[model samples]
Target: MLQIEKKKCFVELGKFLNQFSLEENSKNETVLHNDLFFDSFVDLIHLSQSHNGWFTPEQVYHSVQSWAKALQEENLNQWLSNYDFSKVQPKTVGLILAGNIPLVGFHDFLSVLISGHKVLVKTSSNDQHLIKFLAQYLIAVNSEIENFITFTDGKLENFDAVIATGSNNTARYFEFYFKDKPSIIRKNRNSVAVLTGEERREDLVQLGEDIFRYFGLGCRNVSKLFVPKDYDFQPFFQAIYEYKDVIFYEKYSNNYDYNKAVFLMSNFKLLDNEFLTLKEDTSYASPISSVFYEFYENIEDLRKQLENDAEQIQCVVSKNAIPKSIPFGKTQQPELWDYADNVDTLEFLLQI
Candidate 1:
């Protein structure tokens, strides 16, 4: 299929996704294949939590909306405009997806297909259904696309290149296993926020979205904070109070209770706000229901430290406190070009 055909298929997929939201889902008859897909997708969203306890309706809807916005013509054109597709040759690209958040690996799947390549996908068992459902929708939109997508339950084979996301341990295994194939093997990474004590209440509230979204499972979630020495925690707590209801979820509440007890038993000092805990730690990766914070005396020195540990970080959120840092709450709303681990996926696919 031509690149334009693939693009049109995804554009239609985006329109289908735009119909669903956390507040309500309204069907749009004009969308291609809506009669078959719209109602089924709604049922799938409702059933997502049963498949994976962390896939709440609200979280899944947020991811759907994010993708809907991303697949618009303007966004798609602008992202693809940067690349030259003339030299592209079709190859079967194997994708080993990560199920940390809803549809987390959709970008890779989209990248390979949109670049005029066949995709052999190994959907994480935790996220087996959603992407497969979308693949069916895409094929329905354009039958030509059917030949381009495949999913496997067993070991991946017959693919010329590969993209895999996993923890640090699995990444080591992937590096050795896929040693002969051209690949992008992603490991663990976490996001951090740098606070300068001048943030408005709204900014801090947005930061809460970065921390609490996906229940802090996504790599883009702000798991650490770098604040000035003697930074006041009261206002930050107040801003994040809006998300206090997250504690009502049974799973999150269980994590909160268990982690809090573990900390208390260890005699560790914690800043608690009834729902979330803030601890003083130098680590970037924090546990669910908590964020680790550290004191930084100078911005330059902290920048140097973050640069030194670049591979461990995914994104840095701040109000221009660090170079190229993302704004508060926008970590989860990454653009098409915001490749994970700063690796250019399109470039990799094109070259392969």
Candidate 2:
């Protein structure tokens, strides 16, 4: 398929996805293949949590909604305009996706096909269904797109380049295994927020969205916070009260209970609001149901610290305390150009 054809296919898929939301599922008769896909897609959204406990309907729909907005013609054109595809030579690219969040690897899939490369995907068992369902929808939109995509249960092979997301330990194995091929190997990276203590309740409430979305499993989720030395927890806790309902989910509730117990037994200090716990720690990667925080003496010094640790950080959320910080609660809602690991996937694919 031509590049324009591929873009059009995704745009159509986006429209199909736009109909689904946690609030309701409304079918648009104008969307192609709705007669074949609309109802089944809604069933899939409802079934996602049963398949993967963390893939709650709200989270899945949020991801779906994000992509629906992302694949608009204008967004696609704006994103692709930066790269020249005239010199591109098509190649088969293998993708080993991480299923941390719902459709977490879809962006990589989209990047491969949108860049005019054949994709060999090994879907993480945790996220096996959703991406495949979308791929099927894309094929239904244009049968030619079928030639550009493949999913395998065995192993990835015969691909010129690779893009893999995994933990730091697995990254070591991936680096050794794909040493001969051009690759983008992603390791564990966490996002953090720099709190200035002047944030409005609304700003912090939105920040709660960043923290609680996807049950705090995504790399873009704000798992850590940087606060001033004398920062008080009263305002922060009160601001995040809106998300207290998150504790009602069994999986999340269980995690809160377990992690809190571990922290208590270890004699670590904690600020608790029943649903979430705030721990003072220097680590960027926090466990589920909790966010790690550390005090900073100076904003300038903290900016220097974060920049030096950029590899371990995915995004820095702040109003303006740190440089290039993502606004209060926008960490999870990344633009098309916001590449994971800050590594340009399209650039890697096009080079292959």
Candidate 3:
């Protein structure tokens, strides 16, 4: 229905969103997204709970509004208005979302929506509710969006492009099926922090957020740390231990227990934080039960290793001096300029 010109629609959505204050203590009695077009998003938080983690409805509401604000930016609007949608006409995209973190697939979802393409979402069952809620909201904004979106239980086929997120094992399957087409197939890559031995205790405390958010399941969550061997691990450990209350969650406890038992059975050395178990490993993807860390004696060596391992890394975080291009906080709070998997989503959409 909305073949072109959505200026009024976005304006109305922004006005509707203003009705709910997204501050920490807003009562949850009102419609979250507010517009009749997006009322279906009201149950998203309930859906996140049904999955694995305990995401409050408030968190969902805030994240959605955050996305709305970005989309409503003047420069973003200018870009969308000038783009020739016909360049990517009728693109059929198959997307495999990662559930390691809350709303990780949102960027891809927006890439399709703003590019005017049809999306076939294969949501991670672990975080399926978030996407459904977001889709419902978009559809409410413009009822025509409903026809542009669809859920598929079958194998992806006849798609012009595909985007998949999975572990190394599943990536093989994705590559086998979608390699022939233009696609972005993400394999396991962990975010890491390179401490230059001069990091303040306070920064390490914030680094805890990088490690603990989403229970360390997201790709952006740092599963590995590269610290100087001479650097004392005590302050770093102490900073993270302050948040020992993270273990209060049953989900985190379950992982802690399961990983502890397995580590003992396999004879692995582990450092425990009551909530997180840290170990030394070369790998980046850590289990919900344990995080992996490695020590390096020389900053030069660490830099060299990271340079060699660049292709295998998603991000590098450090308060210490480093290249400006590397992002911090494990999470890719990327700008519109940050192309996913280093590929320009807009360009890819246009090509399709």
Off by over 4 Å in 2: none
Give candidate 2's whole-model lDDT: 0.93
Candidate 3, residue 251: lDDT:
73
Worst 10 residues of 1 by lDDT: 27-36
Q: Compared with the true structure, what per-residue lDDT tens digits does model 3 show for residues 1-352?
A: 3444344444444444444334532323343345343344444455566675546454455455655565555736665664676645677898998876667787787677667788888888777776675567656667777887887767776678998989899999989988789888888777888777787788888788777766666666678888777667778888888778777778778878988899879999988766778788888778875778888877777788888987777778886455753535435445555555566777777887
When superposed on Cα atoms, how far off is each prediction in RMSD? 0.7, 0.7, 3.6
Checking candidate 3 for backbone clashes, the offending pairs are 37-140, 220-330
lDDT of 1 by residue, 11-64 (tens): 999999999999999888888988888889999999999999999999999999
Q: What are the clashing pairs of model 2?
A: none
By lDDT, highest first, what's the ranking? 1, 2, 3
Clashes of 2: 0
lDDT for model 3, on a 0 to 1 scale? 0.69
| Alpha-carbon TM-score of each model against the true structure | 0.99, 0.99, 0.84
